[model samples]
Target: MEKQIDNHYRYLQQHFSYLIRQQALLPGEKLPSERDIGERFNLTRMTVRQGLQTLEAEGLIYRQNRRGWFVSPPAVVYNPARRQSFIEYVSSQGFEPSTDLIGVTVNPADARMAELMKVDKGARLLFLQRRRSIDGRPVLIEHIYINTALLPGIEKEDMSQSLTHLLRNKYGQAYHSMNLIFKSTALLEDAARELGAAAGLPGLHIERTNYDAAGRVLELDYEYWRHDAVTIQIDVNDA
Candidate 1:
């Protein structure tokens, strides 16, 4: 009985794998309903679901609420050392990119924030939250803290667009240096919620601190990315 059940799921997995490899099920195309697949395969619904879950773990498919599974699209490449903005890189890769400002607020820096920004406690900072998408699929959530003292009246400016552009054109400030840290972990509750993913899903966490020519911290950014949505590539040159 155990061997038979194992073969049952493997049979469905192999069938879908063949279809995907042949391009019969194109990327981003929805799969058939679970009931339909079960009926076609002469398997129980649980067995069909188990097979689909296996493919999802292999990065061959993904599920959306209400909507069924879809063939996974090609992962976007992100190079940490690259100076391109999110829109620039995504567009260069032939993907449509967009940003939605979740919210913005001015708040006093707490102890940890003060330490990170090298500012005194209670220093005013701008908190900005944004959700970024590629090809209409929400993939990243960014929480940014800006040192308001560095750019006077910055809070009055539009916050939805690229900060790099705003700094260069408006404040005459550009990125001088940055420190970045990347971690692979489960997505947190708030970030997962914003990305339309279930809590505790595998994710990529990126923490970046931006500095100006004078070595003052300009912004501290926390980015949560869907695990399957991005592929990070970096080129190192020997000194």
Candidate 2:
């Protein structure tokens, strides 16, 4: 049984790699039916399906009901030390950058948000919610909290473009670094609405704390990435 499972996995790895290299399994392209793969491989349909399932679990593919599996697109790898806007980062990779402003307002910071943003409770903060996309498909939903005192005119700024750019260019605030924390959680209704994900589906949640050059808190951003839409890569250097 162990060897059988191993063979199935090994065969799947070869088939998946071939598809990727050949563009047969193009990024965001739905895979063929399990029956079709089985016929092509001369293997049982169950085995083909199991292989696909393994690929999906490994973050190489995603499944949608009635739509089958599709190859996942590469994620935006952000360097914490680099001072570039999200749009700039995405555009550098030859992808179109766009933002859909879900909502934006100034509100009193809650306890949780205060801790994340390093602000006092009830402090005024700019709360901006948005769905970021490359081309047209929604990839990430972000909730950003900006210190109102730092960027006094943040509310009047354009909501359609990169907030970081506006802050650097208009507010004269330069970003020094950002820390990202990751966790797994089920998608809620709000997340589903922004990410086009089904409610209760699993998702990748990331909390980002951005700081200014002077070490003042710039913004606290929470982003929810749709499952299968991204594969995160972390490069660690031994000190």
> Across residues 90-165, which tens digit of lDDT does each residue of candidate 2 receive?
7887777789998988999899888877789999998889998876668789988889887787788887777777
Please provide, for model 1 over 1-239, each residue's C-alpha lDDT reduced to its tens digit, 9 standing for 90 to 100: 98998998999999998999899999899999999999998999999988997887676887786788888888899996887788888999999999999999999999999999999999999999999999988889999999999999999988889998998899999988999999999888998888776676778999999999999999999999988888899998998
Highest-TM-score candidate: 1
- Checking candidate 2 for backbone clashes, the offending pairs are none
Clash count (model 2, backbone only): 0
Q: Which 10 consecutive positions of candidate 2 have the poorest summed lDDT?
A: 75-84
